[model samples]
Target: MGSSLSTPGASNANDRPAVAATLPPAGCPMHRKLEDATANVSPPPSAETNIDPRNNIPSLSQNPAYGQTIALPLERMRSSIPRTLSDLSTASEHESASTCPMARGGPSRTTEETKDTWVYPSPQQFYNALVRKGWETPVQAIPVMVDIHNWMNEAVWQEVLRWERRYFNPKQSNLALEPEEIPEVSLARFQGRPQDLSPKARFHMLLGRIFPNVYSELPPFDRHDWMVRRDGWGAEEQDKLHRYVIDYYSGADDEDGNPVFHFDVRPAIDDLDSLTARLQEWARIKRETWLGEEQSSITKDAKINN
Candidate 1:
């Protein structure tokens, strides 16, 4: 009966299928069961199919973890960068060149160079000229003139202050007379008597009193003839005076033959009465305007109070 049970066809161990050499030991039944269960089942879809919680929640890279994310449009971004008058001018120049049939290929290098030549005068130079011309006042009064030129050069302003301290101030040493004592010489001397005194002498006496260093530094003043000539007088007498100073110094040759004539002072005193009057008028207007506006504001407040 035992021999029959052990036979291949009979109900015996030999009749069962042989376990593979690679199979786990029979002691690990749970592992064997798991392997058998999984052998037929497809693997759970890869982790890629499972949406990450981070993906559902906005990523810090896409949406910042802290602070508001501003969504500026292209137009708004372009507008945000502030433009200056110079930038606007450059853009206009480019636009003009692009639009004009004559400038079909855009501005040539030469054209660009020409455009570059249109530079405004230096403020320091303008202020220096004004100081030289005997406009003895603070810089605050002349915004239009200041706008035309730059601020006074530091060296020039220092020199101007020195002169102001020397002549205008009562306390400073080397001051010949009090500010009140220095006679208010009329502008008529230059306007009226162009031929009586030599240009050098007139400049020496007049400008010398104003800018001692400048008068002392100038060429013997006799070498300059056209500078004193008063053939073309006009309403812009002040302008003429400015031109005289500018032109005389324009080709100024120094003691060492290097160009040195760069002092301007007349524009400093230009339109003094007019400027004073205008400033006064501006103050009055501003005061009246403010008062009117204030009255309306106060009236509204009073009505609300009542």
Candidate 2:
């Protein structure tokens, strides 16, 4: 029986003589039929396929779904193999995230942005993006404040809508181009107080708004409030601060008919004339800076076009 499997010529005793007689010297039909029948016979089991009766050897003839799943050997292998060094799978366990993270669009290093690496889109790009996101108006009176303490906060999205609406109806806002209404929230979290930013914060906001030329390194100078900080500065800084204070409190009054300039550091900047002079100078410098930048940008652009 063993010899019959290995040798084409070997046959069982009862049919040996008849089989030999039917076989022709040169490839007869009977011989061809015999060869065809045995052509796909599997090789003897080795260590890899050393399956026992307890093991389920998946057969295509017995099972055919999903067009086909893994072959019996591979199925057993997939169940048995360990993936990483930390995997405690012992030739048996298979389930959950341990299979293959990469196969399922797992964390892609190539596509993810790094920490503190978000490059802001340009104003035009930002407006376009907002429009794309279904915002009816994408313009804003000011940059939207987006610092939220937690995921539960729903105010951020509302703020975006408010900002967008203000673009269409600038006059609807209580906040003037010069910031008549001071909101107690920081447009950015870094302003220390989330709301009602310090004088310093207000200054930067104004600066950025007015001078649209250098959006890169150069700070902003909005047409509105051009100053911040009532304290913490030397002669020039303090002088400018005092002048801003005066202008900011220009029209209000108290019960006794005194001015409503009750902010701290008023004592330090009592010189009205010097404060006025410094404020005037600050305004002049700010205007000149914006103009200079605008001119330089126009010239640079012309040169490029030429």
Candidate 3:
């Protein structure tokens, strides 16, 4: 009996042009269809496509709403680094040193080094020095006394004047009287004082107290007063007094056209006199020394005229 050909390996038994083996039924149709679909579809792109999570984030670089990020490395570095006080100080110092000529190289010399050394003389010392130099004068002396008087109380001066009138007035003679009745006696006695001071003397005395000057060589009696009181000496005497006072304070030329001393009582008495004398002598010497200069000046003028 011929084996049933429709069983296992059935295609081998059908010898009339034996059929080729085929793929399993389950794979044939579905696999070919899948392959055909895949052929029709495009292949995945080959170029790199970087997908960054940061790109998804809202970035200052791309968004117009956000400020643009600084691109300069220096700007980024500046933002990242914290500045210290020392850095600022160094920068300031550099700028300052550069701007200022003195500060450029190093510190400037101290006041002591650059400035001349000066030793100020004491008040007493200065006065002594002036006296040694010879600058004191009569007018200078008087102002000192006046200054002293001014400093004294007004009541004191009034009392002094009262006593002076009482003791020096010559009209009244009675010294013995009750306190209330003694006005005449007091006036007479006050007027009768031994030291009969003239107005000039009083004025000079006032000045002397105000501006004390040891080097001043004032006459024992007030020459100024005597001159003023003289019967015949009116305007001329007054002029002379005025001139003398002015010369004593402001200085002037002597008879020979030589400059005299300038007497300032600001200094102590001793120093003032010396300074005055020195100034006077200096003026005189200068005049004598410069005599030729004046003559030469005249000669030059004459030549020019000729």
Q: Write the per-residue lDDT of candidate 3 for residues 1-306, one digit (tens) a residue.
A: 011110111111110011111111110011122323232232332345221121111101111111212221111000111111111122221121110001111223333212111111222222222222232312223222222212211212222222223332233323333444432210000011113443333444465566555222231211110000111223432222101110011122334443222211111113443245334433533453456323111111110000
> What are the lDDT scores of the predictions, listed in order?
0.23, 0.21, 0.20
Candidate 1 lDDT over residue span 1-306, tens digit each:
111111112111121111111211111010212323332232333344322121121101111112213221111001111111122123222221110001111223432211221112222322222232223322333333332122111222222232333333334434355645432211111111212433333454465567665443233211111111111233343223221211112223333443222222211223454244334433533554456433212111110000
- Per-residue error for 246 in candidate 3, Å, reads 19
Name the runs in model 2 displaced over 4 angstroms. 1-118, 121-283, 286-306
lDDT of 1 at 149: 21
User: What TM-score does structure 3 among the candidates reach?
Assistant: 0.12
- Clashing pairs for predicted structure model 1, backbone only: 123-149, 123-150, 129-264, 129-265, 130-265, 132-265, 133-265, 133-266
Best by TM-score: 1
- Model 2 collision count: 19
Ranking of all candidate structures by their TM-score, best first: 1, 2, 3
List, residue by residue over 21-73, the lDDT tens digit for candidate 2. Answer: 11111100001222232212333334563221111221111121122222211
**After aligning candidate 3 to the native by TM-score, how far in Å is the CA of 267 from where it should be?**
31
**lDDT at 41 for candidate 1?**
31
Model 1 regions lying over 4 Å from their true place? 1-155, 174-248, 252-260, 264-306
The 10-residue segment of model 1 with minimum total lDDT is: 96-105
